[model samples]
Target: VSEELLFRGVLLGWFDRLLVERPSSTSLLFLPDDGRYARRGIQGEGWRRWGAIVASSLVFAGLHVGNGPEGHWFGPDLLPLFLLAIALGWSTRQTGRLTPAIGIHMLLNGLTVTLILLGASSS
Candidate 1:
């Protein structure tokens, strides 16, 4: 459920690496001067808008859909994941910080793992 590593981590990591690997292409992809973290939704300056939150979350989720089978599905299984991303993005935007989003993301991930464990045990 917590595909943050894939979407946010791996995706951003690759993008950053790309800039160094091929500086010529960075501008084409809209890669900013700061870094992947900032571009990936870590707000700066004033508080970000809710529209930005939604847009960023959508992009985050869209990226996650390319990893593998688990990442490709758009059913109920992934709904919560997308919603969690939205919540995380919104939280970060609203507070102009990243801690709250990270906390909520971790909690949701933990809950997902707990539920899966409980279900398997019960079954």
Candidate 2:
């Protein structure tokens, strides 16, 4: 999906690069798409909309988990991935444009990778 590619791909890839190049200090956040969406205009539209995002996020996280042992289950890993997914999905809906969310996503990922390389910490 374009959404995944732009947000996750850009952020994750950039962070990975930072880890390899810097490996000194950085940080990252795992925001859910719903959070982003909520930031825009997510109200109490009944349980349907709320349920939709939740289900979608779970599926997104599950796919990541299914990737391989590299994407194996880990409390730290799952939490962030799920949260980020929620943010990405929600953002796309909120702004009616995936670019902003992807940009923010990439920024977080970049910081994360940089931190990893810097030996700061993993989130």
TM-score of 2: 0.50
Provide the TM-score for each candidate, comma-separated.
0.51, 0.50
Judged by whole-model lDDT over C-alpha atoms, candidate 2 comes out at 0.57
lDDT of 1 by residue, 87-120 (tens): 7765654665566766777886688789878988
Off by over 4 Å in 1: 1-48, 65-72
Q: Candidates' lDDT values, in order?
A: 0.56, 0.57
The window of 10 residues in a row where model 1 has the poorest summed lDDT is 42-51
Model 2 agreement with the true structure over 1-123: per-residue lDDT tens digits: 465664444543343344323222231134434454443333434344445555666766766663433556654567777898878767765666657666876787688778767774543
- CA displacement after TM-score superposition, residue 4 of candidate 1 (Å): 6.3
Please tell me which predicted candidate would have the highest lDDT against the true structure: 2
* Model 1, C-alpha of 86: deviation from truth (Å): 2.2
- How many clashes would you count in candidate 2? 15
Model 2 segments more than 4 A misplaced: 1-46, 66-72, 120-123
